[model samples]
Target: MEVAQFIIQILNGLSYGLLLFLLAAGLSLIFGLMGIINLAHGSYYMLGAYLGLTIMKTSANFILALVGAATLVALLGLIMERVFFRGLYKQELDQVLLTFGFIYIFMDLAKYLWGGTPRSLPTPPLLEGSLEIFGAAFPVYRLALIVSGLAVALLLRLFLEKTRTGMIIRAGVDDKEMVTALAINIKLYFSIIFALGAFLAAFGGVMGGPVIGAYPGLDFEILVLALAVVVVGGLGTLRGAFWGSILVGFIDTFSKALFPSFSMLTIYIAMALILILKPSGLLGRMELS
Candidate 1:
């Protein structure tokens, strides 16, 4: 490949990786703090995309659609958590089964409303076009995604570090009982965190709708990748998610680009090698699993 082509792939990889980070961040937080395996997490992603499309068509405004979709999905997540997840937290198998059911329900619902065909979202007018760098042009939207994902990551790190409530959350992740003993409302804190994760996942879906067309099976496909990210990054680790997303993103992009003959096999090889050398992942702490 030429230098420009290589740079383009790197940009593409970084953009894709950032989107994965958004989904994986939520998955990690939910798994780490609540100890829940949410098989239906990707459903929220698909939901966000459909919602974005609907909202955009109705309002004729992309920004509003994005905001409205994210808000609606976050609300849906809150409902799911309150009605289903709260009870299922202590029951891993039950949570898995329930969420697994949700995946199919969401897929069927998407098909019924949006049809079985794929749909696309256009980049908003303001963010359309390319930026020149090292004599190569790159999509402005992809660059925006990188910036937004990085900003969110920074905001999250600050939230978990600078504020008292954030400190409580971090403490909870490390030792729930100790944090609870300090007179904190563990339930409330967890609920907020869960909602936050949902927002992240849904937001990612909305932003990625343009690049990765919204379709029926997108949820399962992204879910598998997100699961791998969580496994490779370590459950309940934010920093781990960042590193793991970048690593997996690059591996995924390059494998598909360079090793078209064995693209799928290469990902498995990478995963296996990582697991063999570092079972806990690049930045994850050892878990009981």
Candidate 2:
């Protein structure tokens, strides 16, 4: 590849990886704190994209659509956690089955609601056009995504490391019983965190809509990729998810460029190697099952 093309590819990898980080960050938090592998998480992402599309088309307001879709999904997450997941807390099998079922239910709902048409969200005019980098013109929106992802990473780090609720959450993850003993409403905290995770997924969906678009089977595809990201990044740390996304994003992007038909295989190979070398992941504290 030419130097310009290679440089653009690097940016492409970073942009795609950042998008995955948005999705995987939430997945990591939910599983790390609650030990529930939420298969439906991807459904939320899809719903968010579709919802953002609808709102944007109707209101012609991208920001409104982004926040609205994410807020609605977060509410749904809060409800699901309280109504269903709460009962299945310790029952891993039940949790898995229930969430998996929700995936189909959600997919069907999306079909019924939005039809099977693939749609793309509009990029703000402010981010339209391309910028010259290394003699290659790169999409401005992608650069925005990179910046947004980094901003989110910093914010999340601060939130988890510098805030009381975040501190309580970390504590609860380590020792739920002890947190409860201290009069902390661990269940409420869990509900909030779960909703927050959902929020992030939906936010990611909207954030990614302009690039990946909304489509009929996108949910499972995104879910699988996001799962790989968190698993490779290590289950419990935001830092892991960030770096994992960058690495996986690069692997997937470069593989597609070089071996388009077998890109996913490369990712799996990389993930397998990582798991072999460190079963706990690059920075994971939780054990993989």
* lDDT scores in order: 0.84, 0.89
**C-alpha TM-score for every candidate:** 0.95, 0.97
Residue 95, model 1, lDDT: 79
Residue-level lDDT of model 2, residues 46-164, one tens digit each, is: 99999999999999898999899999999999999999988877787798899899999999999999999898999978899999998889999999999988898999989998999
TM-score of 1: 0.95
Show the lowest summed lDDT stretch of 10 residues, model 2.
Answer: 28-37
- After superposition on all C-alphas, the RMSD of every candidate to the true structure, in Å, is 1.6, 1.3
Please identify model 1 stretches exceeding 4 Å from their true place. none
CA deviation > 4 Å runs, candidate 2: 287-289
Q: On residues 1-289, what C-alpha lDDT tens digit does candidate 1 reach at each position?
A: 8888899989888988889999898888777777777787888888888888888888879888878888888887788878987786577778778889889888998899999889988788889999987788998999999998898889888988999878888888888888779888787877878788778888888899888979989999888888778777777888988878887888899999997888867667777887898887778875557
**In lDDT terms, how accurate is model 2?**
0.89
